[model samples]
Target: CHYCTFVTVPGKLRRAGHGMFLSPDEVLAIAREGAAMGCKEALFTLGDRPEDRWPEAREWLEAEGYDDTLAYVRAMAIRVLEETGLLPHLNPGVMTWTDLQRLKPVAPSMGMMLETTATRLWSEPGGPHHGSPDKEPAVRLRVLEDAGRSNVPFTTGILIGIGESYEERADSLFELRKTARAYHGIQEVIVQNFRAKPDTAMRGMPDAELEELAAAIAVARHILGPSARI
Candidate 1:
């Protein structure tokens, strides 16, 4: 549930050591939240959004003078990856296989995944992803399969509670599993219940019920247990 949000640079802007200075308190907060939820592993990621202005976000980063900090984080991430040691989950959102291949020399063992679970934007009549749902899955699978071919062992997750249905969740898992098999190595599956964070578009929207979460996990476990690690 602590996945990073990369709505700013294309792929490499707010990763580990970038201007993003996470405090000990922040790390502890993440660890506590993850442990409280019975999670065996904690997650972390870099933020990248190539399409937006990010006036406020940029100002904050500039104030922090992240040049040196980012360099250090990059080195640390590389160490973790190269050693194949799990340091939470490393998320590089909406990235291509070519880009991921470049990442392999750094953190081979750390978990990597595509951030395909963001909420849909319906406000803009003709937005970037207006009709993206149909084609995005295939594009995502192509990349996942590539990760498999390299033996990088990765996983896929989703954004639930954003008006997605029981059937949709089941279908998404089924499709991800199918895609993962084609790729070769999948470690685990994660499901995040949608929470309407304050100031977000769907802030006032209701989240999914407990029954929905339980049902989804049960279904996924049943469906993915035989072959891949779920």
Candidate 2:
């Protein structure tokens, strides 16, 4: 996305710097280390389907005998649960019902950031999420609903001050409340503040003030009621 701040290593940056995927053994070793340190959750945060965009990613997946990045994630999650003291918490983006079903048993909980429900963000080429299909409000919302339908505990929330209005923020919270009421599968709502980062498209933008986040939290609590955690 245009507002993203993830660091990228170009193909020529280092020797054979196309990219690399961690092995299942490597994953298990890290999980073991975390377990030894008394960490309760192994949070797996990854880009969705890098194989679709990079030839090197595709080649690596094929050579590794995995169909896709998500498949590898599931495998690693299973390994972590079976071999370590940590519960695997996945943040793989935009999962379908089948994806949720396949991951539920191995992954106790997973997350996808609702970000914002404002359709306007996807309408302009310069918008933060204009090029990110998974960031679309409808697609993200469907993942939340599917997680509910599939009985997978989910974590979702909005990123304040990303060009969305207060009305849109309220709308997004209402949508989350609707999903939580329908299936009782949502476990957490993160009221995150967006900070400007250098080299990002939104670097020049102002950081989200604490007051805005407080407003959102208050609205979230009011909409989701006392039972929901803000």
Candidate 3:
């Protein structure tokens, strides 16, 4: 059975009071429940260092007895392992080598979506990753490199239909393949199609067509080969 739980935290892209801010105990309790209900994995998805961008996030972390979001996540991950025995898969956005090392012990795996390697998205006004510093392709690639150096099994992939050209999508897949070959630590590549939400910045963007998604998957399979899971 595959069951999962998400631990939400403030993100750089989110406005103040955007989501629930959970305490360590609260997070642990959720993990325990998930375990009791037969969950095998817990995904800790947090904003990439919300404290750096939002004063409210920083104050909340400090008041909660954590120096930073990663510290809080580390403690919660340890608790999830020790108390519930679920393998934690962290998707806490961009991370450094030191951050990966710190949480690697408790987490069996971690992930971040490369989204796309196109720099134009960053420069484009109202682009998907516009204003989201942590969403930079170079920074995300560096995180993948760091994860490889740390020998951590990682999950990464591309987000299609986010204002990227077909060529850009291919480029993204190729970059992932190169990184995976170099590190041999990439466990899976998730080929996710973007779904625009009603309240988000990309609300008006059309979803990728079925044929486009199929083509993207075919490209990923060809580049990453049989060993890669897409």
How many steric clashes between backbone atoms does each model show?
A: 14, 0, 0
Candidate 1 C-alpha error for residue 119, in Å? 11
- C-alpha lDDT score of every prediction, in listed order: 0.53, 0.86, 0.84
Among all candidates shown, the one with the greatest lDDT: 2
Off by over 4 Å in 1: 1-44, 49-74, 79-89, 110-135, 226-228
Better of 1 and 2 by lDDT: 2
Instruction: Write the number of the candidate with greater TM-score, choosing between 2 and 3.
Output: 2
List model 2 lDDT by residue over 123-183, tens digit each.
Answer: 7888888988878899999999999998888888888998899999999999999999999
**After superposition, which runs of candidate 3 have C-alpha atoms over 4 Å from their true positions?**
1-20
Measured with C-alpha atoms, the lDDT of residue 157 in candidate 2 is 89
lDDT of 1 by residue, 115-176 (tens): 34223432233422344342255565566677778777686665566554566567777767
Pairs with steric clashes in candidate 2: none
* Best model per TM-score: 2
TM-score of every prediction relative to native: 0.61, 0.93, 0.89
Candidate 1, TM-score vs. the true structure? 0.61
User: How much is the lDDT of residue 141 in candidate 2?
Assistant: 93
- The global Cα lDDT (0 to 1) of model 2 is 0.86
